[model samples]
Target: MAAGEPQAKKLKLEPKQLSENVLFGMGNPLLDICAVVDKDFLDKYGLKPNDQILAEEKHKELFEELVKKFKVEYHAGGSTQNSVKVAQWMIQSPYKAATFFGCIGKDKFGEILKKKAEEAHVDAHYYEQSEEPTGTCAACITSDNRSLVANLAAANCYKKEKHLDLEKNWKLVEKAKVYYIAGFFLTVSPEAILKVATQASANNKIFSLNLSAPFISQFYKEPMMKVMPYVDVLFGNETEAATFAREQGFETEDIKEIAKKTQALPKVNTKRQRIVVFTQGKDDTVMATANEVTTFPVLVSDQSEIVDTNGAGDAFVGGFLSQLVYDRPVTECIRAGHYAASVIIKRSGCTFPEKPDFH
Candidate 1:
């Protein structure tokens, strides 16, 4: 599914002409507790601006502090969930255009996540449990930078047999033409990803994934390696690419070289060559295949209009997936991804307008 292959021939169809469950995404779903707070609040939590870290014992009070003292906003904030929501918004025709699967708790935060997913037109089927009280990320904003403290409460409790392997849910897996997951999910349920990726490859469908964060390559290498063979389209930023290259013993930090090597990795499914996309903030986006490396300059924004940089990567992939499901070419997918990312960076959190005005 390299954007210009025979499979891409499906691009002849309009973007909105897709059926329900056209795209399927799975990962941890977290409620984003977002608000603008002063430097004193950040110092109190021993957090610095622009830092993303798991919640520590010392930071346990931050979520409540944000809710108690500041004007906060909540948005559905998991990486895969955000992408599918953006994809649904871009497609905008058949409601429930994108289907998402994840585990959450039977708590208020989980309720909010479901409500937000519905509001975004994403068909969410969450595995609700009571042992833990939903996962959340406190997005403490100071000017343009955000400090994130995530509490992966129920997010870590995903068991494959409980949801993904069920007959009723597996039907959605079979019905989708494109399957996506964030590498962050490797921490929660790589077994579930293996199940979906194997099925997607066996069925000759497009299977895409992201190197969600740098630590994923460093800490989750075993699971990442097990599923890499089934990936047709891989997305990440230059930073994550460099980290993956170093961690996988690729021995190079140059993104073009890394992309070329990644494309050449052993793939079980021989239908198409793996295509890798690495985004460079404020520089050219690099796309690589077995034959060539191409670059696309990103849209530039003024310093005054930028609101938040969080969720830009997920938004980019969502926009790309919107076109991929429609069989749109790789170039168009990149353009749409850029459009989506640009729109999101102008707003707070991963929230988007009612409809996308993609040209």
Candidate 2:
């Protein structure tokens, strides 16, 4: 199931079974330029291993230096983009099963991202802005760990008026059965989240939100709260879940406790139970539903097979959401999520092989 590994077998769901469900995603859109570097590269760039840093003007020279020294590979990234890609792969129909929305600059990197997404079979609807260059995330990998420097650039131009309602975008929103928005979007456009949440609510669709990172929960608390009631399915890692809990005056760092506390929050959609999925890397993934909190251990491959853990969590959400659209039970959803994560961690960047081994 590793990206470059030999195909084990052909495994896929029937096209007819997949055509009925549609998922929508809106969030930061970036082209990830990745390369393997020596451990000293981190100290040279002042980057902490495994941390996601916002790229500032000062990092421009560092980017230039990396490109000069290493072979680079590009993938369509940004957390929500990664999730949508994995979900589309799981469903086996990118055009029919998923649609992603984001803003990008009318430049070469944007063109690259658009082309790569199409190649991956995702329905990529990008709002092209002439004002800025395409955003990018420089992911430097060393010894299987990744550190990222994200340049928001034109990706941050995701305003409600500029992108959401243009042409057939609103129609796509109306037809979707599930809606997903990355937490990073809150920093750029909270109004976009509200707009999509409102529409998803009116349409009785499933609205899912990924906490993105811990800083998002800390810095964007108000907007996170504003959209929380509308989020029927909430996703976050151990760090993100604990951060949100601490922000709300909870002293506990336990994953199960965090899931319980989040699941108890009031929801706008009363008919649907609030499901909080808390993931602890290499540990059990906790699912908190109306009745109880259940834990499922991550199904990892042999340790030697784990290559780059870059998009593992996002892949998990994609896998989970892929099954969510099919009304699968929570246990099955988590299993699918784990499978997707297992595959992505075996590959570089957020890239996937031509056909995943589903068995």
Stretches of candidate 2 off by over 4 Å are 1-16
Report every candidate's CA lDDT. 0.90, 0.86
What TM-score quantifies how close candidate 1 is to the native fold? 0.93
What lDDT score goes with residue 322 in model 2? 82
Per-model TM-score versus the true fold? 0.93, 0.93
lDDT per residue (tens digit) for residues 1-68 in model 1: 47677656667563447899999999989999889899999888888787667787988888898999
Instruction: Report how far off residue 101 is in candidate 1 (Å).
Output: 0.4
Off by over 4 Å in 1: 1-16, 46-48
Clashes of each: 1, 0
Model 2 vs. true fold: TM = 0.93
Residue pairs that clash (backbone atoms under 3 angstroms), model 1: 11-327
| lDDT of candidate 2 at residue 339, scale 0 to 100 | 91
